[model samples]
Every structure is written in C-alpha cells, then in structure tokens.
Target: MPQTIPKKKVRKPQKVGKAQKGKEEKMQPMPVYEKEKIPFRLRDKVAIITGGDSGIGRAIAIAFAKEGADVVICYEKDDVDAKITASEIEKNGRKYLLIGGDVSRENHCQKIIDRTIKTFGKIDVLINNAAVQTPQDELKKISAQQLTRTFEVNIFSQFYMSKAVEKYLKKGSSIINTTSVTAYRGSGHLLDYSATKGAILAFTRSLSSYFSEKGIRVNAVSPGPIWTPLIPTTFDAEEVATFGSNVPMKRAGQPVEVAYAYVFLASDDAAYITGQVIHPNGGEIVNG
Candidate 1:
C-alpha cells in the first residue's frame, strides 16, 4: 500500500482585534461645511446645483449663498437633508429653491431648468454635481445595472442638464461639472465611477469650445479624497478609515475646501477662463 502524503498545513490570515478595529473606525474624517471671511464674489447670480442636499453639493450651495447668489438646489430624495441645506441658505439671507427629481431623466432635467427659470428668472451658473459610484474589486464583479446607473447619474445627467439649460444661459454664464481626481489618475475599485468622471472632463472641454462663441464658460473641478457622506456609505469601514491617507496631505479634505473652487469658477473672477479644470485633490499632481 502506498503511504498517503501529508498535506502541508496552511495558516489563515489573522483577524483584526475588536479594539484595533474600533480605533480604525474612529479615524474617519469629519466634514466641514463653512469657512470664515468668505467674500461675496457671486453677487446677484442665480445658480443651480444638483445633489445640493448633502456633502460637497451642500457646501457649494451654502458657499454660493454666502457669496450673495440665489441658489436652486436639485436633489433626488431626502427632503430632510434638502430642508437642512435650505435653512443654511436662508441663514445667509439668500433665496433657495429646492427641486427634487432624478436628473438621469432628460425630462426631469428640463423641469429643473424650467422651475429655476420660473422662480429665479434666469440661470447664471449650472453645477452638474450629482453622481453615484459602486466599487468593485474586479471587472467581472461589476454588473450591467451598476454600470448603467453610474453612467446615467454621473455623466448622462450632465449632458441632459446642460442641454436643458443651454438656451437660457447668457453671455458670461458658467457651467461647472464635478469630475474627480480618479478621472486623471484612475481608480482600481471605482472603475465605472472613474470612467464617468473621465467622460465629464472630456465633455467639459468640448462643451466649452462649443459655447465659446456664445460667451458661456464651461469648466470642471476634480477633487481628491474629501470627507463626505458618500465616503462612509460607499466604502467599507476599513477603506473609510484609511480614506485620503495616501494623498500627500495625508488627510481627507473638507467639503468647504473643495467648494471654494466651484465658487471661483462660477464667478466673474474666471471670466477669461473656460474649458479648464481646478484640482482640489490634496496635492496630487496630475497632468491633463
């Protein structure tokens, strides 16, 4: 009888202790919404911000309001969050209109424009900021539905919103799309999200050229890891704990830090600028 060969013993990876896990979870960064001594640069302008209910969008809306612009906030759901943002706008003595709808629909985009026009009379700035992301470890793990939804929300809505508001935008008007650092550097897990952001960067550049003759400026903001609601919800606890740690800054940015870029692009301060992108990405240098 042949002697049975003994299989080599393999050790499983050790699990993190509960105490260490708690310490990691506590490392998550907090989000900041406001800054001191912000100048009123966007005075008398009317702006529309998609996903204005929370995170970076909320910070932008409040920052614009502080800069003396009346804002129209477009959000999908979350009436409570919308109300909170509205309260902040009101605190700054700026008027705010909250319109809830799915921007992925062309018709809804039209309605956003229509409602803003009807209420605010004209649109001076359009911030295409709504986006969704699903992280997959591998390409095969990404589903068709996830890919479609990510594109629809992230890139398609920009096209729809821009088209819907194009005719209304006048000379000196600005359209700012929210891209991401991943658009420049790419993301291993956030494949679909990164692709949509890349598309937005291309769209912003092309649209700027098309609108150049019309005197409407188009630009984009590419942000790195920022402390926002999307962080905790989309990423696992371990990922969230280490979020933004890889950046040169070694910390996640505050929403208000990124909001300043939108304020700059939306104001006449950027009148000579178009087809450009601003990076608020924790000192991550990216070409193009």
Candidate 2:
C-alpha cells in the first residue's frame, strides 16, 4: 500500500530549452503532485505500455506503478531514457520489464504480449501509446515512404498490439489508445499524423462495441499539445518555443497532467465508460 503524503505543488519554470528530457530535468520548479495513498486502485494489475521510454508513455508507466501495477514498457531504442524510467518504476516498489523493439512490426508486437504474460501471468490494462510524427508543410512534400512509416507507428501498431493482447485480456480489462486533438481539429503541418489519429478514434469506438459482450472495455485519450520528446525532436526551435501557447490554458501540459486520465480510464471508476474519449487538451473545447 502506498503511504499517504501531503499534496505537492509544481511551479512553472521561467525558461525552457531543446534536447527533450534533458530540458525537463533542468526545468526549475518542475511539476509535482502528491502520491496516491494506501490501497492503490490498480493494486496487482499488470499493464503494457508501448513508447514507454519517455514523455507521455514514461509518465503513464510511473503512474501505473504508483497505483501498484507491474509495468512492461516497450521502446524502439534509447536505453538511456528507458533506464531512467525503469529506475523510477522500481522506486515505486513495482516490477519493471523493458522490451527494446519496434512496435510497428506485428511480430514484435506478438513478442511483447508473449513476454508480458510470461513475466506477469496476466494482462489487465493495455495502453497503446507509442507513436511517431514528422511535420510537412505541404501535402505534396509527404512521400509514400514517410506516410507508410507514420501509419505503421502511429496507428498500425495499435491494431497489432490489440490483436496480440486480446486473447490474454480477461473480463474487466481495459485498453486505452492515445489519439490526438489534431484528429478532430486537424493540423496544417501534421497531415499524416492527424490522419492516423482519426483512425485511432474510429478504431476505439468500433472495438469498444465489439468487446461489449466480453466485458472488456476500449477507449481513447485525445491530447492537444503536451511537452514531450516528440515536440523537441519534430519541430524547429521557434515552433518548440511557442508550443501549446495557442491553447486556452496557454501552456504545454506536463505528461503527469495527462497521465491521470489514463489512470481513471483504466480503473473501476470507468467501469461504465467505453467507446468514448477523454480529452486532456489544456482546456481546448473540441467536438467529437
């Protein structure tokens, strides 16, 4: 059981920089929150999260561990980030498994599921949160190769991972897919990425209905803009500087902020919710 603690505060930093996690590590007065008290909601549940090395995936992994769920994180590469994430999970007194592979491949997805069950015995929550994006100013600038790659990582992997974990997921288990607000509002530069997010929304709704009788649930989280590795790696210095400023909140959300939605969706609190989406877009009002 997690011990009760006083609520913590996270003050915003005065300056930010590039280099992703390195910048986050140096951000003074970094985001903070109180840990959950005893009798964790996900107490003994096992969860699988792809793209778990950094950013939102990393945040969710830590959140799950805090709730007493063992975590298996799949990352394409980057042992440095994965190692830090593993250490944090261990700090929470939860077992951590790191799988280094490309989730875009069906065979790799199968291996992920097989390994998780082998290590943990059963799967209770599957978070399909891995994705990649490249910005193109014009439609003509997008090549067929880039389009295929984006789909494979962003949406295709969801299909493969879902199929791989479906048999092992028992009743009351939940699957949460990470879609983007761009799917609904559209992005002028992120053409392919937005398209795949739209597909994820439709897929989430369809799968929820398909699994309704099995007592399993499927849902999605759509985020507008959050400070993650993807932002620094995909955009220019100027674009990164002004990231998330246009939102109603006027700031990029921290991964921990968005991670709470996943916790709620995966817990019993959402037992009656499925085929729906939870938006954590910094107060942006988006129509379904």
Candidate 3:
C-alpha cells in the first residue's frame, strides 16, 4: 500500500504577458479611447492638422470634427491610418481632406495651406503638430545630418506652416503648436529634440505677441509622456513599457486628454489665452 503512493505533482508559476499585465492591472492602453462630449463649439470652422494620420494628431483631428469643424489632414505617409482618420471625421458629419506629403518642405507646407483654402475657403485653426525624434545617448553620436533633419521636421516645419497659413488666417483664428515636456526639463537622450521644443515654446510666445495686434492667437501644448506611435517608434521595448512611469501621475497621458487642450485653444473659450503653453504632462510641474 505504501509503495502504491504516487508523488504529488507541482504546478509551475506562469509569467504574465505584457498585454495581460496591462489589462489585469488596469493599465491604460497605447492610445486611450474616448468620445467627445462637448457641445459643437467649433461649428463651421475650418482647421488644418499636420501628422493627422495617427497618435495625438489623429485624436486632435477627431476632436475637431466632433466639435463641428471641417478638417484638412496633412500626413507624410501611412494612407491606411490617414483613411481611418478621414473616416472618423466623416462619421462626425464634418468635411475631411487628406493631403499626403512631407510637411518639413516649405513648398509642401504652402501647398497644404493652398489646398485647405481651396477646399474650405478659409483657415480658422492651424495646428503645427508634426515632429520627429531620434534618441542618442551621447551628443557625439548625433550626426550633423541627423540634427539638421530633426530641426527641419520639428521647428522649421512649424515656421513654414505658420507662414503658409498666416495670410489665410483671419482675426480670432488660432495657431496651436505641439511642444513637449522635455522642452522645460530637457532630455539627455533627446538633446536635439528637446532643443527644438524649447525653440517652439519661444516661437509660441513670440508669435503670440507678433499676432496680438492682428487679433490672431498663437499658443502651444506641452505634453509629457503620452502613449503615441512616437513612443514605440523612438524608444526601445523596455523604454516604451516604462515610458510614463517616472512622471508624477505614474502613467502616460492619453491623446484624448491632450486633444481637449487643442480644442479649447482653437475655440473662443481661449479668446484671452495666447502665447501661453498648456501642460498635459501627467502632473509634472515645470516652469512654463
């Protein structure tokens, strides 16, 4: 009878999947999903959003559409993602125009504005939100070409876009630039990117003052670590996984959360707000 006793089997511990951990711990998904509940504040307005194919750009495009604004989306590539944004805009009963090209080129920026005017007659809002960032641990690792390219796409594009839309923008029209939290705090790995963002903040302030007499408002939105395509594209897997863990909120901000800031800046609600920056960086306090 004693010899007939069999050894008991033990169960091994199982590893948790990233996706499973995300769900089980109620972690925010890559792109936070949300629907607009605000009233139609931007009814009949015409807006242009660069990089509108995905990420924060897509969220802002959708938010603008829901607020009753006709949207002109300028994207470099990814027709699939652009189409998705277009469909969502159309679903909101708003007119959508998709322009595919590099916004960093001055000619392309002009063409974008020209097309928007041709389609919508006037530009009410211009969002210079297209940007790129390449992480390098050491300054020496950043080549001259890479640095130049970053500036072109990040800051130079904003200049070109602003100039292109300036003549078309009427009084009370808004210009919102997407800066970054790194502008204030700085990033060792993102030196060039942070520098450009700092320039954007200065541009926002100076542009706001320059346009004040003309009744046009210029502002910027500085987002901390928002879950967007940029994170996965720029950071490694480990970095991406722990992206917003260092922030005060201990979580990445959703595009939807940042989208509202753009909406408010574009609407009459921010009539007196210009040359200012909106911090949506998950409770990270910074001198703005």
Candidate 4:
C-alpha cells in the first residue's frame, strides 16, 4: 500500500485598500500608562511642564500627578489635548492647571510662572520640555525664520522659564530639561534642532552649577526615538514607519519609559545627581 501525500494549502494575499493603509499609518501612539503602585515621590509638590498637553510632556505630567504632585501644564494651543491631560491628572486625585500659549515668547513664559505661583503658591519643579524641529537636508535650505523659531522654542524658552521661576524655586527644587539624542549624535537633517538641543545640554550643566549653591538641581533627559505624536507629525510616512528601528532596543520607547527619568530627577531619589544628563535613549551611548 502506497502512503497518500496531502496537498499543502496556500492562502491568497488580500489586497489592502487605501483606507486600511491610512488607518494603519495614522495610528496614534500610546501617550501614557500608570503603574499599579505609585510611591508618591513628589507628594505635595508643584511642577510646571511646558508642552505638557501631549507626547513625553503629557506622560511626565500624569506621572507627577500619580506621585502626588500638582502639575501646571503649559502648552501651545490644542485646548482639547490640554483638557484631556487635565482630566487624567484629576482622575489620579491630583490638581492640574492648563495654560495655553507659545512658550517661545518670553512674556508667555513669565506668565506661566506667575500663574503657577498664583495657583500653587510655589513651584518645586520646572520641566522645560517644549520644542520644535524642521528638517532640511541642506544647511542652506534652512531659512532664517526656521532657525530663529527653532532656537526660540527649543532653547530660549528654557532660559525664559528658568529665569522666571528661579526665584520661587526653593531648596531641593529640580529643573529637568528635555534635550534630545540628536544633540549628542547629531542629526544632519535637523541641523538647527540638534544645535538647540546641544545648547540645552550645555545650559543644563551651566544652570546646575549656578543653582547648585541654591540647592536646586538641574539636569537633562536625552530621549532616543520615542513613540509620540511628534514622530508621525514630524516625519514622512516612510520615516514614521521606521522611526525607532535604528535604536539598539529595536523599537520606539513609550512615554512612560522616559517619564520615570523626570520623576527620579524631580524626586529625592536623585538628590545627589545634578549637572548631569540622563539617557533614556534606547541603549544609545552618548559620551558627555
């Protein structure tokens, strides 16, 4: 008797429609997630996070709330996102204030400090995290307007906010700047943006020294590729698809993963750490 050979079943490939592809391409990143147990590391503290309406800033804001801190979120437009963040904070049984404006403006930055002081009465932490980037393959392609806007939003706002809030920050206060991995490794396309980030790193170091005697710790968080609203919005479709593939981790990091660095810097856990930059950059080694 001969053994019967079974024929292999082959499945046909289904054609993907434009709608389906668009839906998949436009998928939003997970903005935040809470831990089962929060330690309340920032209990009773007041923190101001620029760009807190979305992306990494939103994660940091929610994390601060979970840690028992009241947060003041400074955002540039997008009232809906700001309100959503506020709702999240409130859900955590914490207070939140949403201030909408361009952080690039010095007056706006001052206004943020004034409003925070009025509402919270004191500012314990300042997370200078608002930023903007415009990619250009050639340096000559970068317009003066683009360069100025990048610098104003990315670095100048940090200066404006820091100066405005410095007097109110007491001993044990913290300032965490959001620099980028691009600052260290450099980004050919993001010339102005990377330059601003490098400036932020230097600013963080210098500011830490100035505030060291005052007991205020200044540090920077350099995040590699993180899955955030910024990725899809900033990059082309192809770039967005492969956003974090280059990282050693082989994937874009979640907002919560990078938020912990800010939380630690804001808490007593990182009291001895100052004038330093924490790399939440998916295993990329950035010297200095």
Task: Write down the TM-score of every candidate.
Answer: 0.86, 0.86, 0.86, 0.86
Question: What CA RMSD would you report for each candidate?
Answer: 20.9, 15.9, 21.7, 20.7
Candidate 1, lDDT over the whole model: 0.93
lDDT preference between candidates 2 and 4, better one = 2
Give the runs in model 2 whose Cα sits over 4 Å from its true position. 1-38
User: In candidate 2, what are the lDDT values of residues 29-129, reduced to their tens digit?
Assistant: 56554554557889999999999889999999999999999999899987889989999999999999999999999999999999998998999999999
The TM-score obtained by model 1 is 0.86
Model 3 error, position 256 (Å)? 0.7
Mark the regions of model 1 whose C-alpha exceeds 4 Å error after superposition: 1-39
Candidate 4 residue 242 C-alpha distance from true site, Å: 0.8
What number of backbone clashes does candidate 4 have, counting pairs of residues 3 or more apart or in separate chains?
0
lDDT of 3 by residue, 1-288 (tens): 457767766666455566667564544333434546557989999999998889999999999999999999889977899999999999999999999999889999999988888887899999999999999988899999999999999999999999988888789899999999999999999999999999999999999999997899999999999999899998999998898999888999999999999999999888889999999998999986
Give Cα-based local distance difference scores for all models: 0.93, 0.93, 0.92, 0.92
In angstroms, the error of model 2 at 277 is 0.6
Stretches of candidate 4 exceeding 4 Å from the true structure: 1-38
CA shift of 254, model 1, Å: 0.5
lDDT of 1 by residue, 137-255 (tens): 99999999999999999999999999999989999899999999999999999999999999999999999999998899999999999999999999999999999999999999999
TM-score, prediction 3: 0.86
